[model samples]
Target: MWTTLFLSYSPIPEYEYVENSIPTFVAIGGFPFIAFHYPSPPMGSDVVSQSMWPLFYLNEFFWLIIGTILTKLLPQKIKNYSQIRLFCIVMTLIISLSGLGYLVLRFD
Candidate 1:
């Protein structure tokens, strides 16, 4: 999923870290880290998972705070109109395709 998100993003040079790393980390948390909240990640995972749950949400809260600050301070984040349009187009296409693919997989 992160790979697909990256394909949609396709960051330009100046804002690469802001574009790539943030979403990647978010995706990692959304998927792998989230598994810890489920039944069990491993045989002995209960203790570890319980201990880590609060920290996960705390990390996400901090990330949101940082992102809010960055957006306020970095108004020129996108650099140009073309890059913005490209990002929108690519993300729209990827999301649409992914939704259709998911529906197909689910029903078929």
Candidate 2:
């Protein structure tokens, strides 16, 4: 899930430049799933600095692996994943509703 460099920055923030993606949702696991396109890529020399990124799909992939292992290890505690799945579905619905509103209001 990606967009065509659709967002602007806070140095001159505006309403129309907002962009989002699902990898962000899986990565961050919260409200306001923003798509962050840096003006330039982080160099290898800046190791610590790179970790501060708002978006990290690689992190999300590893997290998913860990989460799956954990879920398997704690199936009974999580109610066989049903409860968590329900919660995620509900949150997705809420976010989608808000995003629809955002697009409607953002565009003419």
Q: How many backbone clashes does every candidate have? A: 0, 1
Clashing pairs in 1: none
Q: Give lDDT tens digits, candidate 1, residues 1-108.
A: 333322332222444347433322111223223322222112222233445456546645665677689868976756588988999799979976884453233223
**Top lDDT hit:** 1
Q: What are the Cα lDDT values of the candidates? A: 0.43, 0.40
Off by over 4 Å in 2: 1-77
Per-model TM against the reference: 0.30, 0.31
How far is 43's C-alpha from truth in model 2 (Å)? 41
